[model samples]
Target: MVSCKNVFLTLTLVVIASNQCECGVYSLIRDLLQWNVAGIPIIHKTVKWDFDPEVSQKRREQFFELHGYRAGKYLERIGLGIDGKQRERAYQHAIRDQGKLQGLSILQP
Candidate 1:
């Protein structure tokens, strides 16, 4: 005995709630990026260099020599070594801790 109007209202509320959740996630990512940028030391600051085709080609070749297929396999192995649940828990804890540090009550359902 459910009416179409009631179903529409329910769906609208669910969409709104999901949007709010997405906003929270985006906000958290923004905050994390800000934290990472702030933590970088001035000693390791990046320099802007003029584009030189010769230099670019040399660096590209150097990168491929140092970090080619073996590097990709090494990274994949390291990624696979991490447990999904453990990584999720660590991620959740980081969000909660960051929220607490910023005096924001971020509730994850």
Candidate 2:
């Protein structure tokens, strides 16, 4: 059985891989051409996908933990300040800035 984290990663990859161009074309066209037409090899003889249940389980657990750590680091790299606490500040600001316009419409002049 595929772990939930693995499934999520697969879905994310599929979303990225199945890109749509501005003219409504599948971006896979470029990828397919690159593999078939270009000099890129689809698979190398050295690489292999072997199945071992114990290794698979251990790797999946390690991947889940590592992904969480890496994701946190990446968010920190791009975040404005810190994490979690900012949500409360942002929420309060939104509530304060909603203004007293209970039902006023800007179009009505």
Candidate 3:
């Protein structure tokens, strides 16, 4: 039989191990804003803002909706909630894409 203490411990561990971002809302708006202030070019690595480009505005919105704005709505949005390696990869991708835009704020509330 599982003890209450054990159960609590297990639950705690699960929460700690899971990614905090599940709602899809991004809090890095502050960072993005900084980029905007610095006059850096804003490029959508995952979400394109330009409709004339190869990627459509709608597609970009969808991506932001799924992985950006939506993640912040719930506790699940803390992170990808997947494996650490995958999460790291995704983080790197976002950083590499948007890091250049540091000091420039293009995100809207």
Instruction: State the lDDT of candidate 1 residue by residue for 2-59, as single tens digits.
Output: 9988975665555545555657655555445445634546646888988777898888
Best candidate according to lDDT: 1
Clashing pairs in 2: none
Kindly list the per-residue Cα lDDT of model 3 for residues 1-109, writing each as its tens digit: 9998896566445544444643322324333333653345555345746446756877868777776675453334454455567667668657766834533545633
Q: Ten consecutive residues with minimal summed lDDT in candidate 2?
A: 21-30
How much lDDT does candidate 3 score?
A: 0.54
Name the candidate that leads on TM-score.
Answer: 1
Candidate 3: residue 83 lDDT (0-100): 57
Error of 2 at 32 (Å): 23
- lDDT value for model 1: 0.60
| Residue 60 in model 3: lDDT | 69
**Which portions of model 2 show Cα errors greater than 4 Å?**
1-49, 69-109
Local accuracy by lDDT, each model: 0.60, 0.58, 0.54
The predictions' CA RMSDs to the true structure, in order, are 26.8, 21.2, 29.3
TM-score of structure candidate 2: 0.20
